[model samples]
Target: MGNTINRRSFLGLAGVGGAIFASGLSGWATAETKPGVANDDFFFVQLSDSHWGFEGPPNPDARGTLQKAVAAVNGLESQPDFIMFTGDLTHTTDDPAERRKRLSEFKKIVADLKVKNTHFMPGEHDAALDYGKAFQEFFGETHYTFDHKGVHFIVLDNVSDPAGSIGDAQLAWLAADLAEQPADARIVVFTHRPLFDLYPQWDWATRDGAKAVALLMPHAHVTVFYGHIHQENHHMTGHIAHHSAKSLIFPLPAPGSQPKRTPLPWDSAYPYRGLGFREVEAQRQETQYKIVELPVRKV
Candidate 1:
């Protein structure tokens, strides 16, 4: 059921910090780095799990909430160089037409982003159906690589399985991709699920992610940014750092925080509860980067 065709043959294109109280549309976080590093630095935004069609006691106005995130990014005094929506652009659906509609509406809404360039990967809800045909129809290939400034970014699709697996074909492609890159190049990976086994009982770990991780282990500078757990988590594999972004929709309980994994209900008294975006600044040192999590606020 997984897409076995070499996605590369078909295709193209395309962190975390503490709480700092701020009045901006989103919370502000800044990363500390050596002096002069910020000179050649660049910043980009990451927003995940908008869940556009979700409706219930957990954030009744899901669509409006996503709009506010867009507005928050637009309101930034200095726009990021680009934006990446890690996954779950729309809530899952059984109807094919409705699925496409949700994806379309999501695109239309995000099209208003002041930053022109945007990259997207698929979450299980977005791609598990029909092997992501609907998502690819509106967006492009699920897995691909591109270069910007100097960093090399690899966007992997692991959501074809509910348990999350990258499969062997993509691994081969990734091996070949890394073979061509300079060893010193800064490599950033993006995916929908945690590539490592964070919590298997809740479907949080990737089935064959260990194999992929093994391949990446040879690389000196590798950092993976992903979303799906719906909360901020930081982990390290060898020299690489893996960071999960907080969701724009609703927050999920921390790994094994409770007996089961469930969405934390939004508190009415607290505005923009458990929703925010991550701003990443690339420092002058190829291996150094800083991240700030900005929570959504009333603009």
Candidate 2:
């Protein structure tokens, strides 16, 4: 079983307050996705755990590393319709000022991008302590739905409640939200923590993910994307496919492979520093799906 590492304790040990990354650079990951002629037939980028306010051996220049991730998204030949930053935007911090500063800087970075729509969700690092109240103040609605092309986009907040579960209130909201959609509509779900049992010991999987999955089971086509694990992990459960993206902060060991897992330390020797994201192109008018992990380095 692959394990997802927890970043909360790591942040405390490193004492990332105020400014976590004054300078740093990590690795790279990117996917090649060309858009079709249809304006609506475009792919999107998934960015997670940039941890703008982080300074550790994993990334001596975390700031630079996160910048690279944003640059890659902006440099795409054909821009994505929008960008979704699943969460862990800032390093875990009890200091409200640091949280506010981190998100403020994050906004500046994304504002520089050319994409039209960019959304966010909170990770445990962000919500475990504060319930992501600061995140909501910066990004607006944590859970909402929208239609893109023919796909129904649902952004869920798995970090809003204690125990890292979707909670009864949000669960009810999700049920009602899906009820409003037509039967045949395709759906795409975005979140910070995985909705499946990727690794229970590490708190990587959501407590009530199965209930949420059940809600989308009737749909003909569905895809779920998430972050927080800091690596590329994918699984197909029934009709839904779940995928995780890499962290701009640092790399982590594969799930369950080690007695303890944490983000891999920065290997300056490696090109582009070891940071990356995911590129997903929802196949139009078909059940087939294509998703490629985009590394900061050349494939």
Off by more than 4 A, model 1: 1-39, 285-299
RMSD of each candidate?
Answer: 10.2, 10.4
Judge candidate 2 at residue 279 and give its lDDT. Answer: 58
Clash totals, every prediction: 4, 25
Q: Residue by residue across 155-199, what tens digits does model 1's lDDT show?
A: 999996654788889999999999997665567889888889999
Number of the predicted model whose TM-score against the real structure is largest: 1
Task: TM-score each candidate.
Answer: 0.84, 0.82
Which 10-residue span in candidate 2 carries the lowest summed lDDT?
Answer: 21-30
All models: lDDT?
A: 0.73, 0.68
Give per-residue CA lDDT, model 2, range 140-193, as digits (tens): 877888876556789899886758898888889998988886665567789888
**Best-fitting candidate, measured by lDDT?**
1
- In candidate 2 the C-alpha lDDT for residue 32 amounts to 22
lDDT of 1: 0.73
Q: How good is model 2 by TM-score?
A: 0.82
